[model samples]
Target: MIEKINLNNILFLDIETVPEYKNYRGLDLETQQLWEQKTQYQRKDEVSAEDFYERAGIWAEFGKIITISVGYFINKADIRNFRVTSFWGEEKKILQDFTNLLNTHFNGAQHILCGHNAKEFDIPFIARRMIINEIALPDKLNLFGKKPWEVPHLDTLELWKFGDYKHFTSLKLLTKVLGIPSPKDDIDGSEVAHVYYVENDIDRIITYCEKDVIAVAQIFLKLRREDLLIEDEIIHV
Candidate 1:
């Protein structure tokens, strides 16, 4: 059924995030100690407040979301074109630009929003930040009140689950298992903050995001082909 859906109707997106506060960095030792103390109060699998604060701190230190890489396969066309867009200024302005593009380019079209671990991270992170910045969210992103299965969300990570809920797979590992190149070889999520902060190299961040988007697209192709849901056509990567 996924193949019956037009490829152009899907938006493959990836985001880079950081924290909103700055002063927390100078107190790393104290912060870590406080985080350890706070972990006891959190649910077993949930992130502790201190841990979240630390991650936010790291994100703040690193210029947040230097770019968002998008990939889409146009309908009636055999080729896929990728675009890398940046949120280079204030967070609100960046979100506004992204929203404007989505509305102007993708409005009134039935589309599936695809991303890697997006349901848990990228989507929520962007939405929450947008809300914080008072940016209007697109209709497609207003799925917070909807039931899980009701949303037009396609997380490649979730698809990789293959009906087994307990089998956890990272995007990097999934790509490797599917014989696709691992994008993590060049840059990883952990180093993204450092790359943006220390080096101030936006190209590396953009490249890394682009690599992940490409990897996800490859995986989607593999699924469509091997699962017999789509035509056995060569993917024009």
Candidate 2:
């Protein structure tokens, strides 16, 4: 079935996010209380809300997307290439630019958005951030009333699950087992917030995000029993 889908019609994406505020003190008193209440179970009396605040970026309400990297395949006359690009800077601008990409090129029924564990994370995170920024949801991210089958999203993580809903796999681990190049050679998701706040190197994060996008594309190729992308075939645009 994977071979039946058109690679050109699919847009592969990955996003890097950080906590909305640098620290717990950055939040207003009322919002701080809300954060404590919201994460009570996750903290489980083991760590204070302030101590756990570094991970707040995992939640849509408490986080902002810093960068979104996307890659798509282009084949012309049997010459194959993949182009990758990123939208970075302010959160609102990032969301707006990514929204524009979706609305412009991949808005058709035949177009699909692919990501690793995106059905559970990336897809909804983008939608929530868009709404927070007062941007209209694009057709690809707007999944309000559509039936399950009507959604035009594809998840490489889900595909690897193979109906084992109880199973979970991290992108890094999946890539390792599948022999795809690792995307986390520099920093993992846990360090994204720190890199953005303390190190102040967003360019590093953008490179990491793009690598994840390329890894996803490569994983799809492997799943389809096709050749993986060569270094020369990946273009950073």
Top lDDT prediction, candidate number: 2
Q: What is candidate 2's lDDT per residue for 78-132, written digit by digit as tens?
A: 8999999999999999898888998899899899999999999998999998888
- Encode model 1's per-residue lDDT on 1-237: one tens digit a residue: 666777777778887654444334545686557655644544255765544553552222322455666766654555444443444556677788878867877655487788888888777777776776777889778886888776878988888787787877899988888888787988788776567667877778777887777777778878787331232332323
- RMSD in angstroms between candidate 1 and the native structure over all alpha carbons: 5.6
- C-alpha TM-scores of all predictions: 0.77, 0.98
Q: All candidates' lDDT scores?
A: 0.67, 0.94
lDDT of 1: 0.67
Alpha carbon deviation, residue 230, candidate 1 (Å): 18
After superposing candidate 1 on the true structure, give the runs of residues whose Cα lies further than 4 Å from its correct spot.
21-54, 57-64, 75-87, 226-237
